[model samples]
Target: MTGMKAFFGTFIKEIKLLTRDPAGLILLFLMPSAFIISLSLALEGTFMTVEKSVNKYKIAVVNNNTGHDGKNIIDLFEKSGKLIVLTNFEKTLLSEERARRAIIDSDIIAAVIIPQLDKNRDRRAEIKLIIDPGLANEVGSFLQYSLQQYIYISEIARLNIEKNMLQKSIYPQTVEYKANLGTIASNSGDFSIKKYYALREATTDIIPTSVQQNVPGWTIFALFWIAQILGINILGEITDGSFRRVKVSPTSERIWLTGKIVPYFLINLLQVLFLFALGVYLMPKIGLPALEIHNTGALVILTLAVSLCAISLGVLFAALSRSSFMLSSFSAMILLLMSVLGGIMVPKFVMPPVMQDFSMWVPHGWAIDGYMNVLVKQSGIRDILPAVYRLLIFSLLFFSAGYLALKSKLGRI
Candidate 1:
């Protein structure tokens, strides 16, 4: 009978509608879990976190050195325990071609070839790295840098040994490390990506593994997928002229929009919490490290901002798209594109510099970055405020735009 009563009735109806949608429930719950497990396993050897030292990224090594230098280099990688060296697979020693193929086949992260050293040079063997092009850039760089550090340290030790034997030697500048990445086309693509994902990873005290990135990153992605569901629902109501019927009532537009938003907003929060639960509890059951959060407050506020942003964006889309086909197709395309660019399918560290800059423009990137700060970086409430602020700004803008869009659409502007 009253506006408040009408708003509550509409909210309760919307909540019922959301809960009954089997398709939406499956997409929000089942699909993300599948992606988390599949992707984490696929990239397992490519991404290793500092917290878990027992497991290492797998790399094949081929030693061609005439003397013990090659053996010593292999020893270094093995001793580090961060890289699992596979000198032989199936009882045969790894050759350069076999190693390269191994990387191409996605069996290993990289292939290391230790060339024979020049006896007169008194230097260590030239270590060549053959990386997988499909490998995340941050991942490729981590392996490259790790190998270089090991060889660099070994060289320093070798130089010291020589200096004592000869009683004197000048330390020449260390040779720059070069990595040759195999590409999809030639299978020998020289990956020359200049920017390292390490720049971002270095800010966090703990290195993020594939699982850590997925728990939060994919959760943000599935959260945004809510936009499509909300947009479609609103579009359905509009097509049936249900909105015009409601608009004739005494209830204000705020009540109408709020009714549409609150139900889906709550659903989105549950989606995030559910995914995070899997990360913390179910992930370890599969042998992956359990997702740990440093600040629950940061996560809670961030989730609130993120869900608000997504629902508002959905409202904006539903208002703008006049037809079912237009709403569904465009919103799905846009969400998928944003997900790829937003570090959902790939980590921000995996993307190049220009794309990373572009990611800042979207709320998905902000949400993903915020969640990563909380989960991986062990960042506190203060640390995630900027991200929370950005997401809130996005929600404000989207809601304003959607309001204007709806007003114009009803009046044929």
Candidate 2:
């Protein structure tokens, strides 16, 4: 009973002392708020805006086909609102060397060379596409995909026209003698309706669902890493003799540690809640669907586990180091490296196979994976249990290691 009271007294005193210093208070509260607000606003604009309008590519088209059909196809490409066709390329401009130089100079994204159309040969038109490798990969892929879709649609339209013409021709009617003299309509002999049907079905949705699903996970991962920066303030106090003085009191060290970390854990929880609210409320305004928060309880539990893991790591590092400056530098480096490896900086899907294998060992990776399971996948507790268990195990491991290291250091000091 006495110990509990003493601990509470000490905890209250510590909070009071912390708040008395304007700089300390600002470091603890104002700085984190500012960072969170600034980062959240900045990222909201960068990632959430779905209707990204990209400029039409400057494409030089060399059409060797004098046929009206080939010219009509080129006209269709131009009218699709995707390609800005340039036809002024003479022999010198059409040379491969010149095209390569033009791409290097950023004069054009691609060049389309159409082979001469011969009616005697197969009707398939040969089109050669040249794209700049230096351009952004997404931009290049988008251009290529758009061009391919346009070509497919044009071909389907031509096929449909020819099919309609064939259907209009009357065939000789064959009559069979029947008792009732009823004429049966002959079955259209296996008309190739499959291709046109498939095209119609496939062309409905062009934008992928994965892009919308992945961006929120990236935002959550980044915010957690940035908020974990608050742990450095604990190390700052330990270096300046504040923690040592507090330890000399009758209060239990465990309770004191709890008091110090509770605020940070709460801060992390607030961040998670804010992210959830933003994803649910604001994202839909920008064309993204509201993420289902059906597993809010599980998300809270997982986030606390991750926050504890991070805070324990910070404490462990602070206790092991003798200098506050060294702690700050080392902790920042370690966290940033972990964040990068954990897919906070880059999506895990695009990572190399070896890196994907390595990420499983990182604690932050597990944390990010857990959040993604719940928020992006709309998964329940069962789906995320593996990642949650990993985070809990990491938290315990880091807590034990940190406690032992702190105890040993305090014994010497």
Candidate 3:
């Protein structure tokens, strides 16, 4: 149809305009690529949390007793098989000072200090438990309980041996131990855990999310910026009466509108592919972990959806602005604010609940989440379908706004 000719004509005009603007293309491609690489490298180190699991934790035991009881308690801890037990420091017996240093240095989670137990219950030596403040509360409690159960067992074994030797001894039946607070003092000394890093038990298994956020975050940022340029271009054409001329031409308005979006949509896709490729292949060469993709097919589809959203946002930008300066300033301000809330500048996992919900409310949030699901999480197409749907909805809303503007003289300018 002649309508198709109008569409192709507009599409080609957009392309020729793009080709004439080499500086703009460089700003689009070169600037963002450099920024993505640098920021990704910059964020390689940040708040990293280790998961709390038995095999992953290490503990130390300091036995000053020199008696079989201390050895027996060590045996109990080792037998539990919940964590690794280190009884010696540098091939020698572990000292209290050394054990404390180890806990501070993050070599071990906690240290159990068993003092010499007196034969008389009234004059018994107290055991001490010192822990890293960063340790999970449950880990501290678990260690304290383990110390209690087996320390008593050691005493009972000693009493049986003494009874076998004399055959006519009656000891008190009750077990009484005093607990104090502060530094790991005597066994009867206070059981207090010191604060080290105050780490949380909950953690993700992948690379630091701050770093994971950079590639996708900045890429989405770059893609959305296309809206600013796209909006400004539309405003210029409108002010110059280019679109007015098109309205009077034989071209169908619908086809002409679609043509306007496709060029920038293709540009957005290329930007995404270029940025993501650097994240995957070039990052590891610079000493960071390579970005991993969970599903390639899903990634391709999601990229298209994100590109569509960016193009839609461009249309909305053009619809709202009456001048080039207005379009530029408005799009930049709104895009950056959205970036902050969308987990582009800050990863969502680290954000508080209210901000996280706000981030999800924005279209940029959905686009980044979809990229993360594909890049970081082990997500299938089915898992990402909701994000894709959300992006489609955002596109629809933006296009509707642009359509309404076009019906008025503002978009025709």
Candidate 4:
């Protein structure tokens, strides 16, 4: 009975002390809210543009073909508005050195080098486009298709003029030849010129509504990890004779530990709830999909599991550290390292395959993956079983280690 009473007395005293400290109060409440609001605002302009623009490619054309046809093709390309041409060349423009320098300086996305002459019997000019492989395949493909179309049109026009002259010479009595001056027709025949032009001008959607819906999960996990640092402070109390006094009283140690963790867990849970609420309310204002509250039970359960895991980690850190300063520094390093390696700082898909494989071993990665599965993927409980099981296992391991550490330290004192 005395042990139970003493534990409660210590727990209550700890709570009062935390509440009295302005820094603790801010860390518990205000800091999390500010982080969420600031991050949301910072990401607002990144992917939510109303007027989308297709990226225009700058192409350097080196026409070494000393023919009128080559100049006409170059003129047609410049008039297309799809390419920006650079053309001040004192020497051979298609030389290896010139093309390499043009690409290095970012003066052009690609360079078209028309060979001086065709040595082969085919008589087709050797046109090679030197391109930056780092550019999107779409841009590179667009330039190739445009060049092919120009060559095809020039050949077709030349062929038609020759056929007209041949007919006039073969039969002097034939009707006078006159060119049809209508707009050029599409080679594919499936689309008109107007439709092709419109399609070329269109842009693809870069970011999706579903991606924005998942942002709350990221924000919630970040706050959970940061708040877990408080566990170190709890460990400090134990080392400094606080837990020893409680052990002599009537309160159960188990209940006292529960009380100590409950406040921090609730703080994390509240932060998750606030981020979700803000996402639901403000997503529509920014032309994003409104947060869908599907499977609220699943979301709640997942959030609870994540919060429990974070608290367990905190407890483990506190029990392991000898002093408050050491605990704080160690917790900060752990949190930062986990956040970076676990995809909190960068998306997992963008990471190298090796890093992606390595992240699976980290607890934060499991937590983030589980939350994303439920919130973004709209997965059911059964789908997230593996992640849930992993988190539960980690919580057990951390809690057991923390409990054993606390008991051992108390025994020594």
Candidate 5:
């Protein structure tokens, strides 16, 4: 009963100390909100717009053959939403020399040259393509594939027409010619010609908005800074002998440490809620997409788990540091390095493959993944179970190590 009273007393003391520090509270709450809003605004016009616009290909189309087959190919390209076919008054305007120059000097991504079709030949004519050097392989491959699609459809139509003509014994040249035009116009499937953005998962293609990315990322970052401040205060208490006085009291070390951690856990959890609230309601009023929480219950569970991990990290840092400067420097380096590796500064989808694999090793990465699952993927609590379990395991390890270290140090003193 006496130990329980001591625990509540120590917990209240820690809470009072934190409440006394207004600047720290502001750093924990307001700074993340500011960072989320500013970065979301800066990225809104540039990255999102570029990602959406990069799919369109501007290609010069030079049609030299007036034959139905050749004109049909040009018409196919003109109708495709993916390709912007440049039309010049002269069919041969994009000659070999001009086509090369156009690709090098300006907006053209590639050039398609349709050779004159021989009316007497039984074979299909070859199409030549001159593509820009940088994107030559990709653009050229797409053009070839699209061309093949048209050819395959036309060939199928031609075979069917020949079968009918053979049965009727009335093989007219006009019939085959009509089939080619009709096939190009009527028989195309929804084949994606150019992919603008690569998908991370086959199940969903929606990239979370800039707000969705920044809010969770910077919120995680801010939580770490909260831990740093907690460590700094712990260092201060040690220097000033406050921890020594607590050691001499009736409170056991375990209860005292738990008391210290619980308040900070609550504070960090509240901080996350404030930041997310700003992300949801306030950000959209200023022109950003409102933060969408697909599962509020899952978000709460993840946030609670993340807060415990961060608080445990703070306890570990406080246990190891000998001075305020050491605590600040080490905490900053640790958190910032984790943030970079864990996809806080840049989205993980855009990170290098090596970094993406490396991110899974950090608790920050697990937390971010959990938040992204809720926000972008519209995941349920079950979907985030792996991340939540990882976070809990990290907390267990950090707290256990920190407790042992603190006990050894206090035992010597």
Candidate 6:
């Protein structure tokens, strides 16, 4: 038989062998879907939880003012939609110890003590706000904003009331206005207030959800899981004399590698589609927000680029690691380390600044960033070109390394 026929025959045999391996099929397909679903479900409400914590603030009001200022301050807190006023606290729990305990226990987020303002001495009110130190800076910021809003509105109300009272003091004097009214008459053409309606809602191009990140993340991980299978296949062929037979034939190493790679590449692409489908459809059905993609074309390009990188890495791993044990161990270490660096285990935003910068060195980093640009940032195809180019470069590097490793292995044989 010709070398091309042998290559095609070997490719068919390998595809059949892979189809028969239940564990490999499960690893490639089911595991990633399950992980994406579980992690997405677990992390779906993270943002909402933080938002709720920030919006619903329990604030204790210690009103000590003798006049209407105390009542007005308390009224302001009561009227606020953001703050839940915790009243009767001063009478029941007068000690600062109790207030501190309340804050420590998270029963109340903050305490606003309205001290008796000496209207004669101080121009501005000295309102003391005791914030929960355990909570992050965001809590303090929100509390400050709420108080400022109240103060602004109250000052405006006071100024308007004073203006009204002052206006009442002066009787409506038509005598002065009557003299200038004739001279003030002017021609006004189309003098209309053009009331422009502006939308108050903020527009975001892309909103990243837990699912969009995790689904692609685990899918990338599972794609690299192909390395173990590739290593096993390469080792098995050598031990069984298939590699010797193929080596002696007219078929080139390139053709043999291509045959092996094509099947896995197609499989990896299918795996990505399955996970993305889960993110797009199944997740939303289960009440989790579906993955939002701005450019599906960009996503497809990224998927293909990442799959090629993954397959090439598998080839390099197989060529270097001659034994199944060594392949499994090295592949696991590499995948885990890359996943961490690539922001698969943890989101990139929460990672240390150094790690965030270091992640760019890995192909997975480029893949996830590209996916995020397409999915979360609503970036177009042009925006993701850098990531795709980096992935291609990594694929080229891995393939080159695999060729060198294979040649070294063959020379020894």
Tell me the tens digit of each residue's lDDT in model 4 across 1-413.
65556556656866687677768656655554455455556644542331112223666777676655456557767887777776654454455457546554445556776555534435444567666533443466776777677667755866676678788888868757755723432221111111011011101111223334245436545555644556766776776777777667566567678768766766677777767776678656765445666678777777777777888888788778888888778788888788767766555544677877767887777766765565544556775677778888998998899978976776787
What residue runs in model 6 are displaced by over 4 Å at the alpha carbon? 1-4, 50-207
> Per lDDT, what order, best first?
5, 1, 3, 6, 4, 2
Write candidate 5's Cα lDDT for 303-352 as tens digits.
98988889889888988999899999989999999999988887776776
Cα lDDT for residue 43, candidate 2: 49
Query: What TM-score would you give candidate 5 relative to the actual structure?
Result: 0.65
Using TM-score as the yardstick, the better of models 2 and 5 is 5
Q: What is candidate 2's lDDT per residue for 1-413, written digit by digit as tens?
A: 86777666755765575566668444443444344344444544444232122223676666664544336546756886866777665435465445544544446656666555444754454555666432333555665565465555545555554555555544324432222312211111111111000011111111112323334444345444433344455556665677777678766667767767665565556565665565577656655444556677777777777777766776677666667667667777777777778765654645677876667888867876776665544456776778778877877887788877877766665
Tell me each candidate's TM-score. 0.63, 0.53, 0.63, 0.56, 0.65, 0.63
Instruction: List runs of model 3 lying over 4 Å from the truth.
Output: 47-211, 410-413
Off by over 4 Å in 5: 53-206
Better of 2 and 6 by lDDT: 6
What tens digits encode model 6's per-residue C-alpha lDDT throughout 280-366?
889889987667665789888888888888888887887888687888888889888999998787877567779878888888787
Alpha-carbon lDDT, every model: 0.72, 0.55, 0.71, 0.61, 0.73, 0.69
- After superposition, candidate 4 runs with Cα above 4 Å error: 1-14, 44-214, 226-228, 286-289
Instruction: Kindly report the root-mean-square deviation of model 4 from the true structure over all alpha carbons.
Output: 13.7
2 or 6: which has the higher TM-score? 6
lDDT of 5: 0.73
Return the lDDT, model 3, position 262.
Answer: 90
Model 6, clash count?
0
Candidate 1 overall Cα lDDT vs. reference? 0.72
Task: Name every residue pair that clashes in candidate 5.
Answer: none
In terms of TM-score, the best-performing candidate is 5
